[model samples]
Target: MTEPADAKAVRAAETAVAAEAPDGAGASIRAEHLVQRFGSGRGAVLAVDDVSFELDREPARIVSLVGQSGSGKSTIARQVLGLQRPTSGAVTYGGKDVLRLNRKQRSEFRRNVQPVFQDPYAIFNPFYRVDRVFWTAVRKLTDLPNKRAADEAIRDSLRAVKLQPESVLGRYPHQLSGGQRQRIMLARIHLLRPQFVIADEPTSMLDAQTRRGFLDILQDFRVRYGITTLFITHDLSSVHYLGGDIMVINKGRIVEQGAVAEVMAAPSHDYTRLLLASVPAPDPDQRWTERIDIGQIR
Candidate 1:
């Protein structure tokens, strides 16, 4: 089914707002002096040191948090998605202080700002149908009854993510390929129809070719659905393809922030430059292992 003209226009208007820079009022996501540390004993480590940025949010703007393994890219995502709270800092979303909200207070914000995790493979359970995720979504967002509305919602979500529901509904997680499973996660976002999506390394597990293809899918979603996105990745190469505005993080701090092309062309900080230099050039003789294991995250 096609999106309605009014909906499309609303999305377009939202897109316009998101595309605005920091000078305007469209900063949908803002983090101020954000600090996140893990463990309080002898082994305490800083996950996100002092990250800060104002991202224009609506539908069209695509912001990337690029950094190294310990740069706290995913950590920032968690704080924004409300999966984790900052040890000391403030995250204001649409004029609401995220930390101030109780479970019931934050429900609407939670629905508006959903998350797409890194491991697409682990998104679903093998014992349940793919719709189980949607079941949880329905329970949280709407009061849909019976199989019919639920199934239709699932199918529509699948369509938004460019997957055929008939091919995927009853299938187990193991039945689909890596990229397909990731798209299914995207489908869940479509059902939720969030204003913003915090995608924490959503395509990180895929091969280089698949990863590149998945970028288009995400961009299309941002454009078509008018969903603002926080695309977080440790790799800098992805910035060129996905980032409209860039936030370079290192040792838990935001070292740089600006337009994607400008940041790529002339990165101000040495750390950001080092990151830009690290993007694997498309060399014919180069082999792609695409493995950057940073140990098991808790």
Candidate 2:
């Protein structure tokens, strides 16, 4: 992490900053001057360039990060998850610089923020029981009493994602529908009860019906656990449906960011207008499987 900042020095800076902007329990996550680059200082590819955002209050509020491929949304999400250290800035969870955290602190923060990756089909193993995924998560994150207590926690967690726990038990990932498997991923995080979820294109791989259902299920989780979400997608219509606030990114930069209504109704940035122009219109003649991809936008 010293490739970006010295950890001891960062702790001191965090201490000073926390004294100034004491967000208390309201601040779930925050990123300041977040930059992710690959290569050297003078010449490098900028994956995420000085991007800064925060989620304070609005416990279950949903925010969507919309951008083309390589626009840095995923990179920023990784930074928020503490997977990648920032090249320059800082990412903080509850007043501390999380990138500087030790193993114990890192594990604790992980329970607060978990990722729900796209492509649910690839999210699991054919070898291990699907329940094993959840069980392993529980083992790593918590120390419950016994198998019964762990099983109870698993059941409650699956129920949170609208899954029938009994139906999914002892099943392999390949046996479940794409939706069910994705729900299992959500269920795993719910078991941990993370305060925020960074969902990277959670619905991209599903069919239209399943995609809509995915949205409903996630919204249900929000209602159940009061989980704030940084929902990442390239779909404008999906954003219209689920986003409380919208941030449009282009080539590793934020073009516009604000409430969904204001941003979409009157998109000031050209890139955002491009996104608006690019929403698929319903055509009865077209195949229902018509998909939205990065290439479709002009």
Candidate 3:
């Protein structure tokens, strides 16, 4: 008897997951007293001011960092991903500092923590076919035996994100819609099954419908694969839709942090209230009537 292609892909993914699963107790990624200051002296700007948070490896969750532009939410994301070093504080994974990890540990850290960045087009090369991204990841990250296994895994990952392999595999970035490109990034996340997904304003470039779909996919990732997400966005509605922990950031600080419903319903911080008030009501009759003065809120 012969095995089916889909079944083979499934078995391969299962094997990969089992092989890569962390040994011993679960771990966490923690940011302690992080501060990112660009430049020097009086001219120095504090991008991330003493920000701290943790994402645990077990019991996957989605924690949203909500803030307007320049609030330092994206900087926090970068810090967590180990892309940018903080001025003072530390980003640690499994009790080891990310910045100080050795080559082997760093490779493990990179594999365990992946990012779905804001601009889909910017991540892809204009000249290369879309398949290159997956192939590169497979070659660099995975221990798959051959090209056949890699191709099957890539196809399976695409299907997991609800993208048809034939439609997406060979096309260039320009050939795909923004939604498709973004979904391909999600597909990559699915393929890797990283413990933490740093989604920095992933839906900003998407339309309302597409944005909703993208959020749904993030939620699906949490539920199905136990993947934790640091979902960074300026959109309060998206935060509400995501429905988990929410941290409201203002001027490089976390003004308030709590469950989404609790924070949305009764925000303690003035900045949080202002952010909530800024969200437009679905019904025209219940819309915000008064003009918001930004100068008054801080």
Candidate 4:
């Protein structure tokens, strides 16, 4: 189905925002001393407190922000995505502060920076065909001039995500499993070919087999497309699987951060050690209740 002309024009305007910048030129994303607070007085809460980090373009790295619930990881992701303004500090792409960008620059930012949200079901409309999600993204985010070309692009992306277009094209969201829906999300992102991706628990909903498959595709993108990713999740196992830098956040503060190997091998901070110790082991004797010290929880 073709998109309405008005909707198509809006999409064109959004993608055109970054037309001046050569595609893929903006490689790095940096969060500088960001602080996001809500409410005031006693009711006020600091969600992300003075968190700063950078995702470098060189090596096309995956940066994992690991934290328990309420650690403010999602808040930081939102700040980076330009969905929410920080109370202080800034998120910059290629050295330009995202929140401070003009309309055109903001549009460019949108085109280059894409997000794969935590809930695949929440991202799609139940009423539309699953393929509609892919085609709609093509209509708005890309400039493939004709139907034939667009179909080829869609087919390639679906294959990349391990979804056969013939099987998934005419189906609705409910007709697909959680894993298939997540793959669709990845396929949509593949079509956009964004420089940086904000992946908020992208694999959290899938089963073991499907989870690994989804993550493999993501790793492939990092290696092949040179896409830098801000991977946010509560799973330390996933962090280890992705094999990148790890930043451990606790109660809105960064408890520890460094290369995944370095942090895992010798966690200097109390919270980091606590997180590592909390990981469940296959040995029945290695119970978390016994290994974890209650005193170090701060």
RMSD (Cα, Å) of model 1: 8.8
Compose the digit string of candidate 3's lDDT tens values, residues 1-298.
1214222222222222223444413668999999999999999899999998888857888999988788897778878877678999999998899889776666677777877767777777789999987887787677788999989999999999899999999999999999999999899888888888888888777777788789999999999988999998877667777899998888899889988999988999988878877766545343223222222344
Clashing pairs in model 3, backbone N/Cα/C closer than 3 A: none
* Cα lDDT tens digits for candidate 1, 59-88: 468888876676687678767765567998
- Please list all clashing residue pairs in model 1, or write none if there are none: 59-226
In angstroms, the error of model 4 at 284 is 16
Model 3 scores what on Cα lDDT? 0.79
What would the per-residue lDDT of candidate 2 be over residues 11-112, giving only the tens digit for each residue? 222222111112244656888998888888788889888888887546577888999877888788878877778889989987789878655455556666
Go through the candidates in order and give each one's C-alpha lDDT: 0.69, 0.74, 0.79, 0.77
Candidate 4 per-residue lDDT, tens place, 147-211, comes to: 89989999999999988989899999889898998898889889888888888777766666687
Clashes of 1: 1
For this target, which candidate reaches the highest lDDT against the unseen true structure?
A: 3
Provide C-alpha RMSD values for all models, in order: 8.8, 7.0, 8.3, 5.7
Lowest lDDT block of 10, candidate 3: 1-10
Candidate 4 clash pair list: none
Model 1 lDDT, residue 232, Cα = 83
TM-score, prediction 4 = 0.87
Worst 10 residues of 4 by lDDT: 1-10
